[model samples]
Target: MTIDDHKSHLITLGKFLKQFQTSNSVMNSDIPGNNKFFEEMNQKIDSAIHHNGWFTRENIIFALQQWSEALTPRNLKLWLGEYDLSESGDKTVGIVMAGNIPLVGFHDFLSVLVSGHKVLVKLSTNDRQLLPVIASYLMHLDSRYENRIRFTDNRMKDFDAVIATGSNNTARYFEYYFKDKPSIIRKNRNSVAIITGNETKEELEKLSEDIFRYYGLGCRNVSKLYVPENYDFDSFFKAMYKWNPIINQDKYANNYDYNKAVYLMSEFKLLDNGFLMLKEDESFGSPIATLFYEKYQDEKELKDRLKENEEKIQCIVKKESNTNEVTFGQTQKPQLWDYADNIDTIDFLSKL
Candidate 1:
């Protein structure tokens, strides 16, 4: 099959995904194979929720919605236009997905396949239910995909190159194991927001989505805040009121309570809103139900510090910044071309 063939299959899969864009799924009759696949897809969503508490229905649907928007014919063309896929080498690529959020490693999977390479994927135990169903849908759209996509439960071998995402510890293992091969081994990284005192309330409200989406499980979620010294957090906490319902989830509330207790016992100062805790910390990666923050006296110094530590950050959220800052509320809604860790997946796959 040609590059257009792979693109067409993905476009069809995107149409199927559009049906489940929201928790209240509405099947579209125009979608091919919808009658056979729609019900099973919904069933798998339920199974994913049961298997991993973090995979909530709303979050799963949110991921599907983002992908549906991303996989349009125009979006795909614009994204792939920069590369010459016709000359892309046909090698087998192995992908190790991270289950931190629903469909987290899909872009890498899509990259390998669309770049004219076969993919051998090892699904994270926490995210196993969804992507294979997607693969099945693609295969149903065209038989050729059956030969190109494969998932493994055991050790993976026979791949020319690999892309793996995991914690800092596992990243070391991936680096050593794939040292002889071309690979992209991703380590732990977090996103942060620079809170100017003058941000509109609307922007802060939108920033709440960046903090609370997926209950802040995704690496793209804003885990830290850099605010000016003596900045009042009244407006910030008020803006975050919309996500108060998130605390109703047992797992989140338990974390909030436990972390709050630990902070109190340790005599650390904190700002509490009954659902989320704000603690002054210099770290980028914060624990769930808590947001770490640091007081920045100078904007220039803060940017320089962040730039120096780019390896530890996945994204920066700010307004009117010249650097590669993600707009507020958009950390989770990255475009198809927005490569993670600033690494180009297509470029890596094309080289392989």
Candidate 2:
């Protein structure tokens, strides 16, 4: 199929996804096989939750909705506008996906296909359900996708290039394993938010979304805070109160209880709101149910430190902070152009 046809098929697939989100149940105006597709995807959602404790319904829905928004023709074209797809040829790009958050590796998968390359996806055991069903949907939209996508649980082989994401330990293995191939091996990274006492309650409330969404499983979630010395957290805690229901989940509750106990036993000072805890820490990889924070002497000093640790950060958030800094609470709602690790997957795939 031609590149435009390929793009149209994905756009249809996106429209199909929009039909299945929680709040919107209505079928699109004209889509064949909608009933069966919706039913099957719903079943996959249930299976995914049963397979992984962290795949809660809310998190899955948020992920699906974001992809639906991203799959529009405008977004797909805008994201790929700079690249030339004139020489469409088949090359297999192997992807080792991460299960940290739902569909976290989809951008890489999309990059491979839109660049006119075949994809061999090795799904994370923790995320075994969602992508295959989506792949089935894509193939149903157009038979060409059937030849374009493949998934395997066994060791991956016969791929020209690779993209893998995992913790720092697994990252070393990936770097060594794919050393002979053109590859992108990602390491653990966490996001942080900078607070200046000037933030309004509304902005803090939005920031709570960045912290609690996906239950802090995503790298984009704000696991650390950079605040001025003597920063008062009273207002921030009040804003975070709305997410108290998150603690009601058994897994989250257990983490909160366990982490809180560890901190107390170690005599570490903490700020707790019964659901989430904040501690003064120099690290970015905060424990689930906890947020680490550090005092910054001033904005300039914080920016300097952030620059020094740029590789460890996925995104930095601040309220009208600067051109590069994300607005408060927008960390998770990334656009198609917001490449992970500041790496352009399309450019990587295109040049291959």
- Top of the candidates by TM-score: 1
The TM-scores, one per candidate, come to 0.98, 0.97
Clashing pairs in 2: none
Per model, state how many residue pairs clash: 0, 0
Those runs of model 2 whose alpha carbons end farther than 4 Å from true positions after fitting are none
State how far residue 64 of model 1 sits from its true place (Å).
Answer: 0.1
Candidate 1 Cα deviation (angstroms), residue 273: 0.3
lDDT of 1 by residue, 1-352 (tens): 7778877877888888988855468989999888889999999999999999988989999999899889988999999989987778679999999999999999999999899899999999999999998989888888888999999998999999999999999999999999998999999999999998999889999899999999998889999999998999999999999999999999999999999999999999999999999999989999999999999989989989999999999999986545578989999999999999999999988887
Question: For model 1, what is the C-alpha lDDT against the true structure?
Answer: 0.91
Q: What lDDT score belongs to each candidate, Candidate 1 first?
A: 0.91, 0.89
Error of 2 at 348 (Å): 0.5
In candidate 1, position 127 carries an lDDT of 97
Give the per-residue lDDT digits (tens) of candidate 2, residues 1-352. Answer: 6768877887887877777665546776687557668878888988999999988887898888888888888988888787777674588999999998889988888888888899999999989899998888888888888999999989999999999999999999999999999998899999999998999999999999999999999999999999988999999999999999998999999999999999999999999989999999999999999999999887887899899999999989988857667988788888888889999888788778
Clashes of 2: 0
| Model 1: worst 10 consecutive residues (lDDT sum) | 318-327
